[model samples]
Target: MEDIRDRILRPGVNCGQLARAHRAAVLIDGESYFAAFRQAAMKARRQMFILGWDIHSKVELLRGDAAVKAETDGAPITLGPLLNHLAQNNPELEIYILIWNYSMLLSLERDPNLRFNLGWTLHPRVHFHLDDEHPIGASQHQKIVVIDGQIGFCGGLDLSHYRWDSSDHEPDDPRRTTPAGDHYGPYHDIMMIVDGEPAAALAELCTERWQRATRKSIDVHGQNQWDAWPETVQPWFKEVDVAVVRTEPSYKSRQEVREVETLYRDSIRSAQRSIFIENQFFTSTVVCEALEERLREEHGPEVVIILPKEVDGWVGNKFMEFRRVNILKRVLKADVHGRLRLRHPWVGEQPKHGVMIHAKLMVVDDIFLRIGSSNLSNRSMGMDTECDLAIEASSPEQEAGVRRLRNELLAMHLGFPTDEVDNLTKETGSVVRVVDLLSDPERPDSKPRGLGPLEAQEEQFPELVSEAEIVDPKRPLEIDRLLDIFIPDETTQHSWLRAKWLWVVLGVLALVGLAGAWHFTALSDYANREVLAETMAGMARGWTIYPLIVLAYLIGGLVMFPVTVLIGATAILLEPLPAMLTAFAGTQVSAIVLYFAGMKLGRERIQSMAGSRLNRISKHLAKHGMLSVTLIRILPVAPYTIVNIVAGASHIRFVHYVFGTLLGMTPGILAVTIFTDRLLAFLRQPDLSNVLIMIAALVFLVVLTRWLKRRFT
Candidate 1:
């Protein structure tokens, strides 16, 4: 049989014909993606707009060998300072960034100690805004950059932190940097560059996103952020029709369209040769289901996936890892000819330190290139907003370029030359043949390698598991059907009987505890006087020190009574003026503990626990780190005790949680301490005005608690 590639490239069925309608170029990995994006940005004559789920301005567009001297300034280049210069130099350049409105509660309300509002201080020429009101919790997750309607980028690479690095991938290279602090690993991502008609289509997509986010039309003609166009950065492919696919559940209600998900399904079904993919996540049941169908066919095309061993964050591992594992199982079952393979790149023997794959891309034969920010998951398909650029090459030269790019990626993975991989493809007939030769399980070379020294170091660490498992796709549960498992069944009489028995047991315990307290207090006059005073004061003033202590105990129960409770107890017992200081200490300790817990739990388990009330709490911990956690704990709206428990369960880190907690709780602690001191003075002296102020404070606390419960729940 003729090889799949040859069949696709054969006369009349030429792969070039599919993409000839537009101009296109292949970005093999992160290095190429950034180079292409920077080149396009520099050459823009009309406009520059970036749309993403999350856009971190600190990301370097060009690094390592691609770092070039600035035309206007002689200083070494960085994206933040350089963009500022570009905007000043070209007044016509309008740079707009639309990112997902990560919940305000998580981003701002939870982190009280942060001094800078990152969204506000990006750049003078750059405009940033959180995209909310797009239907409940839906997000804007398209990673696209358009310049002058001439060049466009669409793929998984986002303008985010820790994404910057050189293709040299030297593990010990002192040049690696991260916005989130040290200890973070490097990353690998991919994107597609296109021009001509395809570029125009991407521009339109950006305009549409801007209109949706801001509810106002934007004119791209006068807003181009770059000076004269650089001819070198122009699109590589010429004259091809590229279709724009988008997903936004909020907008779907207004317009009956499901383009993004449909595109994925149709594209997978249409593949007749080879399907190559690189994604940050691989947990989409629908996509997996489609692949399973293809795998069952004896003549199905080969499937290849490059992914990180796990996602970056702790919550990501808990929530997404399991689903990905399950999805891979399904893929493996269909690999009858051993035509499917999944590989993750690691920098060192320890999986934690190496660069992880973060790119989302799919190349089908040499004809179609699909790039986008959307992960292969249900949430990205329609639940969350997403956008993609699909470019096809119609000419043989373009097809050859695409083919060469694919081989280059394979070469990098296999430690073989791009030319050698291309020759092998021509000689052997299928990608599987080349992959098998380079990826023998018994051979050390078959194991994935990192960029350089990172791989060497990782080799010294414990090896990761590589055995494949099988999953049955037919057992998937529909969303509505799955809800039945949580709902109660018909057993009204039995439930009522159980409730009565539980109430009786609770009442007996309460009576016994009350009697024991009375007996213990009777033994000491001071203890009895303090107990009576606490009861009377709580009833009369609605504020009592005993209740506060009890509240601390409740918090301890919720957060598994972590170190926060002990610290808070110590502070309360020792400190006079700073009574609330203990609460702050406790909350901070709990937050740190939770962060470490989340990181240790990993991604697969997290996804399984998503959608619950506790899951939302976990997400808040992951999204904001310690800052947000401490803020919420200090803010008096949510119970400090509950927050601590949720924090530990969510898996936030210890250092960030502790720091953020200490900083965020300062304001609240001071306020509460002053209020408590004033109340204590009123109790001792019996001042009417002081009593009134205390009453007001009590009322505020009650009202705040009600509001917080309603909002967060």
Candidate 2:
């Protein structure tokens, strides 16, 4: 029989040099992890390295008694202030922070002032850098904290708001508020604490990311800095091998690394009796396919997946939730032995929301335990950046530690003591049986805590959700590939050709309708007898006529007069402020009409018109929707209405769409409206000021257009 090491730990599957771990503890959630990190950070004598996707400046590091004491001693408790305090007080200590250059749309959730980035930069010893070097849609998603190269933390919890929660997960904890005093729900995540050579190895990983991002290096650990390990936190495992793995997308020059995916698949495949998992997302097709294969085995492991009942944001709703259901269907079909159990942890009886299980954790048959930031999503598999660490137990002591950690996690979810879980497992000789016992009717409060099974159902509007796959792709995307998905290459007629034909027919009808109005209406007869310019000039002077003309422009878009024509006409006919207001209002109103029409039409019909581009846009929007929409609006990459229609049809949040449109259209609208008004004045009176106004408008338009294009492209 192959050993667990031989089955799981290969060179590429679990990348990086396997370092000997002198001691390791599995910190269950951000509350415990943050507390431990605080103690370690306080004791650090030399250096500290912190890396994350989102690191808020105002996150409270020391909670409970530690926080109370720190406050008593006149020490700052929040992350940014605390780091600054540490750096200032300990002159010899060097601190480095690397955070992902996340979307500006998330400004409300993160540090809007960017004090974490700028405030830390002002400090001499505390160096901070924003990692924006990855692929367009990829994120630097690893969360690692190394203190003085002696103690290391790697896992899902970022030092940010809405992540600090204890394992008890009280349904209505008043203490679960952000620095801004915004209350959040209960959360769950895990971080692995390591000391000795393994800690040094992770410290090296942090430095590598920092150096890649900043193009500069600092000596973090000159000699072994093992003296800084906190005495308070107990180690679960001693003298075990640690495997550091990562998922890096190929960008510019860096080669893609998918060690996390490979390790997960191999671990699932090698499970002898039972497999347990906890993650923020369960949407990786590759990972799901692997589980399916394992489930098909006659004597395969019983898999238990603990996940969040609902994804967090609109993008998450757009991409992950539906994909999860589809993936869940595939897994359920393969579970012939009735072995797979998918659940979400709940707090009280019929809780309002399930505890958000953000822990990227896995365990197999008490032989292997893996933890890190790699979620079971396509992004984590190969697209976005990730890091995962694992240990394959080789001795009795290591096995005991792995088993203990697994039970601890399961116990927390089941709302039972670890000893109860241990006894139940021993009595039944099966982890699956233990789960059955905790959830049985005979047990007191047998409602299984918050660990409830997720029921499979037919997802509503599967195509709308499926379109998100383009944005939340499993692999790197090329421009050509994205275009192909959105706009088909084949000229050959297909079923969708009928939809295209209808659009062409509609265009012809629209032109005919416009012509009929001009030829048959009273305006056409009036135009034949009077000069058009003089009539428009007289009409512009009428107080009610100008508003009526603006109304006509807004309504004209429904029948298809090019928006540019309406904009130019509005600019030429009216004075600057009225013209600007008219154009902006008309354009926005027209966009809203198309947007609503698209949303009403549904995704399948829209796909027939635009093909996979819908998916590509969805994928990009998932990660950076607000920015993408803003850029598209500013640049006029496609027709203005078409952009709105696509966004609405694809179910991009209404708020995001409106915000992008409002901000993006400002410069162009002001430039064109002002330019046309000044040009008309120059023609009538030929004043020097009017000429200067036109020149300034031209410069603004050119500069704004070029800047926006460069920013995105």
Give per-residue CA lDDT, model 1, range 1-713, as digits (tens): 23343222221211112223345655655666665566556655546877766655556665555565434334324555545656666787777777665432223212222224342355567776555424333456678877777667777777665666655455655546654455345667777766555566667767876765555588655333433333444454566555566665633125323566666676677778788887777767778887888777888888877777655553343234556666677788777876786766554344424557777777787776666777787667656667666655567966776677678877776666779889999898787677777665466655445322111012211111110011111111121121122222212325332110101111111222222233335533423324534543455433355445545444444434333323433333434454565455445544555445544443445334332323433443466676565556544433343344345555466566677667766655554555555566677887888888878877776776566545543
Give candidate 1 regions above 4 Å deviation: 1-22, 64-68, 71-76, 104-125, 179-183, 222-236, 251-253, 347-354, 441-713
1-713, model 2: which lDDT tens digit per residue?
Answer: 23354558787555655788888889888778887887788877788999998877778876676678766656677777778888889889898889886543334345645643443344688887677656545678999999878889999999888899888888877778887799888899999988877788888888888766765667767336246666678888888889888998876545789898888888887888889998988888889988998899898789988888887664565446778888889999999999988887787765456788889999998889999999999989888889878998988989999999889888888888899888888788787777766866476666536466787656753644424554467876442222232333223325343211112111121232343345445745533312433466676556775666666555666655556656666677677788888777777777777778777764658666444435544544645656656766776444465566667777477778777877787777777777777778889888888888778878887887788556555
* Candidate 2 lDDT (Cα, 0 to 1): 0.73
Model 2 residue pairs with clashes: 345-450, 346-450, 471-619, 485-612, 485-613, 486-612, 486-613
lDDT of 2 at 411: 89
What root-mean-square deviation over C-alphas does model 2 reach?
A: 16.9
Task: Kindly report which residue stretches of model 2 are placed more than 4 angstroms away from their true locations once superposed.
Answer: 1-5, 70-74, 104-122, 222-226, 350-352, 445-448, 480-713
- Residue 383, model 2: lDDT of 83
